[model samples]
Target: MRIIFLGTSAGRPTKARNVTSIALKLPDPANGFWLIDCGEGTQHRLLSSKLKLNRLERILITHLHGDHIYGLPGLLTSRSYFDGAGPLQIYGPIGIRAYLEGVFEHSGVHLEYELDFIEIDSTGIIAQDDGFIVEAAPLEHRMPSYGYRITELPQPGHLDLTKLAELKVPPGPLYGRLKRGEDVKLAGGVIIRSSDVVGPSVPGRIVTILGDTKPCGNAVILAQGADLLVHEATFGAGMEEKAEAYGHSTVLQAAEIAAKAGVRQLLLTHFSSRFDDEAVEKLTADAQTIFPDTVAARDYLEIHVPRMGSNASSV
Candidate 1:
């Protein structure tokens, strides 16, 4: 899986960054991508990105804030232009459905495809499929907000060719049955156990993407042991008081959460527009003091999250 940052600025857009849109591209292009947060100008940002509107499968909103959802209506409307645009699923806070319906109603805009909204009232498992399970938890923000934890399902282990060969098993339907964890009885009446031949199942990856929030217990719970943790860092180290007052987190606080969660990597985003390139670097440096795996996310930055137990880095 890969994460593409469409906009990384906080509150409003800057020359170098937009607000807070992110794309989580699946390994298969055909499966399309899932969007997290749709800040204003998000569709415009996608024009420059490799992601396609028709391939967008689901959208997960972190909050109802203007910076997080202002672009949603435009994006939904624009998606109709793409050929083969299938049904879309949107998950967000309770007011999200009303918000979208209100916009479409007032604007007199109709969509070509089906739009399904899953309004979240409580926190738990929000979505589950054959490939992934997504859970949501409340976050500490100015208003109602949430964080998502996406866990990929475990994959089947490889079949042990050597062990099969030693057992005199030929490559045929018997191999398939053995791989499926079924006991296979040979023509000679010898039974072979799948566990004795197949390797262990491979664990899937975990990714946690949080909304604009102050460092909170739920954030740690959502991010615990995640392969990648995406957190907001709207201020530098010295602005803790202001950050708390505004319902935001500083870079240091973000790093501390990542550390406590024991995540493999920390991605710091939703930066305040006040911080220029030099200031961002300084904040990142300070964060690294607490969590060495912390990375400051910028607009258009792409991070490839490798599978669990892989030697690959998430840069």
Candidate 2:
């Protein structure tokens, strides 16, 4: 899995960064990508990256804040020009559906694909498919905001090639069946059980993405044991008072949440445009004081989620 930061600024766009947007690319190219927080000018940002609008499958909006959703109508309309023709599901807070509908209706914009809008209220599982399960939790913000937890389902165990060879299994269709944990009959009339050769099942990965929020319990709950915790740090380390006043979090606060939740990696985004390079560096340093594996996100920055057994880092 890969994480691409399309826009990392908070509230508004800066010459250095845009607004809030994130792209989560699946392992399979055919699966396309999932978008989080389509802020203004998001489509223009996409054009600069390798991301294709037509390949966007699902869009998860955290809140109705303009910085988080103003680009939806434009993105939706422009998608058709990219040959986008499939079902696109968008999940968000209560007013999201009405907001999109209002925009589309007012502008007379038509989409080539089916648009599915799901409004989330309380905390619970929102989406579950064969590959992943998505959960949402209400967060502490001025408006109705939410945080999302995405977990990839457990994968099948690896087949022990040494054990299979020891069983005199030939390199043929039988290998596929054995790997699938199905008992296969050999030419010699011997039945081979997959359990005898397969390793333990690999645990899935968990990724948590939070919207604009102050320090809250829901942040820790949704981020528990996550491989990557994408939290908004709209203020610098020492700006806790200011952050709280604005219903936002400081870098230190976000780092504390990651540490408390036992998350492996902490990624800080949605930065205030007022932060210069020196201030941003101080925020990163302060966040690292609480959580060593923390990264300050910049626009267009790409981070690969470490495989189950690997170390997490930005590519």
Candidate 3:
């Protein structure tokens, strides 16, 4: 999986960054991509990106804040023009459906595809399927906000080619059957069990993306053991007071959460525009003091989340 940051600024767009939009692109085209938080000008950002808007299959809104959702109506409208004819699922806090309906109705806009909205007012598993599961938890923000924990379901292990070859198993359709954990009987009446020729299943990746929030217990719980933790750092290290007043987190606080959660990678976004390159560098350095594997994200930055071995924890 890959993560593309389209906007990384806090509150509003700046010359260097835009506000709060990130795309989680899965390897499979059928699964498409999932968007988190679409701020104003998000469609323009997508236009500039190498990614195709038509491949966006789901959108997860963090809150109703303008910096997080102002671009939803325009993005949905533009997607229709780009042949995005597939059903799109959207998950967000309560009032999201009403907000979108009001906007679309007032603007007299129509969509070409189906839209499914799942309004989350409490913490629990929001989505679960054969391939993955998504859970949400309330966050400490000025308004109702949430953090999402996306856990990829564990997959069956690879077929043991060496074992099959040693067994004189001819390479054919039977190989596929054995790979799928089915017993196959050869023409000679020899039965081969899949488990005997397949390795153990490998664990899946865990990713946690949080909305604008202060350092809280839920944030730590949601991020625990995550391969990648995407959190907002709307202020520098010494600006905790200002961060608290604004219902945001400082770089240090973000790093602290990642450290406490035992996360492997920490990607910090939603930066304040006031921080120049040098200031941003200082902020990142400060975060590294608490969590070494910390990255202060920039717009258009691409991150490929790593996959671990079977020993890694899975949901």
Candidate 4:
């Protein structure tokens, strides 16, 4: 899986940053992506990449703020233009269905694909499909907002071809059995044990994304041992007063959260427009003081979640 940032600026777009939108690409899945927070110009960002928007199955909205979802109607219309297929499931806090409906109604926009919206109020698992599960928690925003956690289930252990070849077993159901940790009995009392062929199952990966929120109770739990954490640092350490007043976290606060949660990698995004090019480095430096694996998020940044036994690194 990979995370591609479309817009990372907070409040408004600046010379170096846009707004808030991210695409989580699961190339192996039938529905390839979980598109989160379609800020303005998100379609333009999509057009710049080779990612197929038609493969998008889930759209997660953190809040109803314009900076978070102004690009929805445009993206949905653009999907129709591209002949997108399948229902688009969207999850938000509340009033999101009406909000989108009102926007489409006022704008006279129509679509050919189904659009599903789930507006929730409490913390719980929101969606589960294949081997992935997504959970939502309320965030401390000016408006009713939410943060999402995505967990990738571990895959079956790799098959041992050499062992099978030694056993003179041809390619067939025996390989499947070994991969699933099942011992297979061959003809003439020849038994092959799964322990002798299959390797250990890999650990699952977790990604936690917090939108426009302050450090709160659920944030740490949601981020515990996460592979990658995308949190908003709207203000730098210099503006802690403003950050607290607005229910937003500063750079240091974000780092503190990552350290406490024991996340492998920390990505600081949703930066205030006041600090653009210089802000990335300055805030990144401040965050590094707390956690060594901290990084400032930039527009169009591509982050890869490491494979089994691979080390995690910031993009």
The numbered model that scores best in TM-score is 2
User: Per-residue lDDT of 1-315 in model 4, one digit per residue for the tens?
Assistant: 889999999989987788899999884635478788999989888988768778888899999899999998888887876664678898997888998899999989888888998998999999987778999999887888888999988777777788789998768887887788888888867988888888878777899998789888788988999999999999888788898799899999999999999999999999888885875797899899999898777888888898657976545
Q: Model 3, 44-78: lDDT tens per residue?
A: 99888777878887899988899999999999988
Among the numbered candidates, top lDDT falls to 1
- CA lDDT for candidate 1: 0.93
Each candidate: what lDDT? 0.93, 0.91, 0.90, 0.87
Clashing pairs in 4: none
lDDT, residue 303, candidate 1: 93
Q: Candidate 2 versus the native: TM-score?
A: 0.96
State candidate 3's TM-score: 0.95
Return whichever of 1 and 4 wins on TM-score: 4
Of the candidates numbered 2 and 3, which has the greater lDDT value?
2
User: For candidate 1, what is the total of clashing residue pairs?
Assistant: 0
Residue 247 lDDT, candidate 3, scale 0-100: 95
**Model 2 poorest 10 in a row by lDDT:** 25-34
- Output the better candidate (2/4) by lDDT: 2
- Can you give the lDDT of residue 130 in candidate 1? 78
Sliding window of 10 residues with minimal summed lDDT for model 3: 306-315
lDDT of 2 by residue, 36-132 (tens): 9999999999999888887898999999989999998999998877774588999999989899889889989888788998999999999998889
Candidate 1 positional error at 301, Å: 1.2
